[model samples]
Target: MLLDAKFTIGQRFKHIRIEKGVSQAQLVDGICSIAVVSQIECDRKYPSAELWGKLADKLGVPLRELIGMQEKQMEVSFQIDMVRVYIDKADHTHALELIDELEQRADLLEHQRIELLICRAECYRTARVFEKVVELLVPFLQNQQIRQNVEDVVLCDTYNKLGNAHYWLNDFEKAYFVFNSLDPDDVHFKISNCRCWNTLGNRG
Candidate 1:
């Protein structure tokens, strides 16, 4: 769930730094001035991507999690986490119940929309409600704005879910088409191609 990264990044960094007993001077490490780090910690400024990555590494968390606090601008972190836990438990019914409300908040941020869609799609996948996953993902995948703007990992995840749904529905051609559209260089494409071909081979 890649997110905007500007949200709560500073606060999270500060907290993690303190928890890890890392000093302000240690965190500075020449990536930026200590004052700049202070500004970032206070949410007074946003760090450059490279600087933030260094900061997250020093703090011992993934840059993705920094924004994934984006679940972007996760005003509803706890609510979303509950939905995630339910989905992971394969309780789609319960997850969907919570998801309906989450969808409304998604309208507020691009990352939220992507995150909620991912969560919904995964819940459907885990529940074997493949149709719902397809239904939930297709428009987002096709929306030029959404498609172009979505994070690389999020786009990959969207296509992965859609491809899996189509495969399960025995729509192998659609599955292949979707998976084939992934970048040849992407590792996921190779993995899915194997599964896609196996599915077709078994049918043949």
Candidate 2:
């Protein structure tokens, strides 16, 4: 998840940089010191509010778009192996109970709720209730706080799942729409893109 967040922020910064068509040094001029911009893009440090505002102004984006609030919500990083063990060995009832307990005590930071939502969506997906996944995820996509917190991969996965669910219901139009919402250049888009194309072919 940390990797996903890092990549998302990096991609956003790169997108803004390209949109502005300015060199790193040029972007730093009169905005932030050159070293600071370098550090921010490299994910070594977050930019200050003043620097964030300047970047947003230069890049023609909303100031909120440049802020990453998800980092604050990550209180503890659970071991992936432990999670896998629980998923693999525990019964559904027990798993649900554990998840419910975790959710209740999560106490997530500003944007951290998105992570929780994603986790919940996955759980719903595993239960083969795709409707529940959609129910949980669609709101997050539309929410400003959650949207800002989501990484590109998470966004891709959410859209892919939504498309998949619609496809299963033979709602081809909705599936196609969801798949088209993804940016082709994003790493997570490939599988959904293929599925969309395949569905189109079948329909034709």
Candidate 3:
């Protein structure tokens, strides 16, 4: 299934509003009707940038952070792409430096942990550090809290990363099992499944 690349402006507003425990009436502060605010939240209508600024001011999130969500997404994607490039170039040292920077962030939120782990795991995969990947990922997999709230794309990536670690270690049984657990429609699952079968067929 296709997913939105970033949160909608209204969605970012709604999440912060709920987190801050601010009511709709309180948020609008007589500037607009609660119905209008609700419509904005549902993405059925547009809220002017000025109005969004006011809402962001009340919600305690930076206006740029909310309105520029797509910008932030691009920034993050570029960072990850750089890491991947480093790995492909056999520059594990630089890739680890980048991963370490992410790990050092004191305010990393729950939603971001999985993505960071995925990046680090990719570096480890390139380094052929299979045991390190297993060490980092197994606990993430078993974390009830993370599993309960993980995005579908992240979940699929996690499965592929872990399965590949096992696959590279000659643990074909476990590797195929994890690959099979991924969502059938996910590209990660399909690619991993084909590799698993092809490898097994060659061995046979």
Candidate 4:
């Protein structure tokens, strides 16, 4: 089936809107109702070709620029999703193989690469490969490039996973240190806090 169109209409709309620096209300401009614009941007409805052309014109991008080609990036996303499914099923070896292949082919956007690394690290964690998890994640923590591009949630989760690995390896001191590196307000820190306390209690 034509791969169900790799690019979603909403993603295209949002991308174009960001590129144009136009708000949805501004874009509507009475050509369509604001509610209709909101719906279209949210992918509740696909715009007709006429509307799409109007949007492209206003955004000053070629219509093709708004649409993604169903090629390498889409295939990488599909493979990552499949690996997630396998990971959820506790199929670590299969997921690792898939991740290795996807990582080779993945022309991942910066954020996506960080997410994929976190996912792979979690897979290692699940398999009790504590040292491997640490090895995979520590460099990212030290990486200026990753720090520049990674969101706070991804950073926090990386710290939390690294802490878990240390905890598994009986390195309670390092686990405590890594867990403390996360913000107290972060959700991942909250989850890791409980583990940290439990580990500390046992160590004491």
Candidate 5:
């Protein structure tokens, strides 16, 4: 399973427990300590098979049901991995095709959706389809929940790509604004900034 899939499972597990009115102490009373339960629910640790079975019983669900979630996530992860490979090879046509399929899947967790959008925007940017890149990523970057939930690296990459799209379109004002919004301490941001400067100098 993808690392983000583990995160999704943890978040979904917590949501289910809350909806069922099962307290942390109540859920893990016999199977494990509340600390262990907390760790699992927070994505800090994975549960053992024995623990998974006990938790499933407590929640009145089948173990296979829980396992099924992981399987679906793994399947999605494989497709996303293929998208990355296609992007790396400059195969934007194929990358966009896979991204289109990913966008239609309702089972994708929030982080997965964010990743798909980023990948699609990148394909557009690489193909010199700057208008499409901006159209695709602008709303995603505007969502506060998405910005807060995604990893720093993912966020950085999104900004970098958006900034580059603006730069290519000769929208330097927006490009600078986007680039300046990133953290100065991030190595990715610094590299992106340098690229922007180089592009500007070349034009000058």
Candidate 6:
């Protein structure tokens, strides 16, 4: 499956609007009907070029800033696909190199940045460099600004990876804590938690 950013123009518009504390009525106050704001944010309707420009102006952002991310997200998605291929082939060196290059670029969106960090951590884990995985993801999870932007599924998987990294590093206490922090009913971590419990029991 392709790694998609999944943040559409409508989602972007809504995200920025909410972040700026702009109500839907406020967003469309002079530009268009308030009902159109919901349509646009829901992606049920696309704004006209004139309306797009006006909305951007009202939001105090450049017009391109609103439209440019879609293009960049496509590019990041393609690059992520390539990284996945390299990783699947066990070419972690190349994967890490590409991930590092992407990391250095300043244009990455929040979701894209989080995806790359998780990819980097996965590479480190596959290379048996668990410390590097912990080093990379621990600080990321701790940062509320960054962590809040991640999708729930991605966040669940990230927590699982981080917990496993801790487990492999023989930091059982930290591993247990991380595992326990996951929702008990989360299907994503159920098997992982079982393994964790079994390992801890054996070690105990």
Per-candidate clashes, comma-separated: 1, 0, 0, 0, 0, 0
Task: Put down candidate 1 lDDT per residue, 79-103, tens digits, no spaces.
Answer: 5665676565455775687678777
RMSD of 5: 13.6
Reference-based TM-score, model 6 = 0.59
Candidate 2 at 196: error in angstroms?
1.2
Error of 3 at 143 (Å): 1.6
- Please write out the lDDT profile of model 2 over residues 90-169, one tens digit for every residue: 22343444455455664545444455566566666666778887787667667834447666776787777778877776
Model 2 alpha-carbon drift over 4 Å, by segment? 1-76, 79-85, 88-91, 110-112, 144-147, 202-204
Specify the poorest-scoring 10-residue window by lDDT in model 6.
65-74
How does each model score on TM-score? Answer: 0.57, 0.52, 0.52, 0.59, 0.57, 0.59
Which candidate leads the pack in lDDT? 6
Candidate 4 local accuracy as lDDT?
A: 0.70
> TM-score-based ranking, best first?
6, 4, 5, 1, 3, 2
- Between candidates 3 and 5, name the one with more favorable TM-score: 5
**Residue 184 in model 6: lDDT:** 73
Judged by lDDT relative to the true structure, which candidate is superior, 1 or 2? 1
The clash tally of candidate 3 reads: 0
- Give candidate 6 misplaced runs (Cα > 4 Å): 1-74, 145-147, 187-191
For 68-157, candidate 5 gives per-residue lDDT tens digits of: 345234478766765665676576876777788788998899888888888888888878999999998788778844547877777788
Clashing pairs in 2: none
Off by over 4 Å in 1: 1-74, 144-147, 187-190, 199-204
Model 2, position 73, has a per-residue lDDT of 38
Q: Per-residue lDDT for 135 in model 6?
A: 92
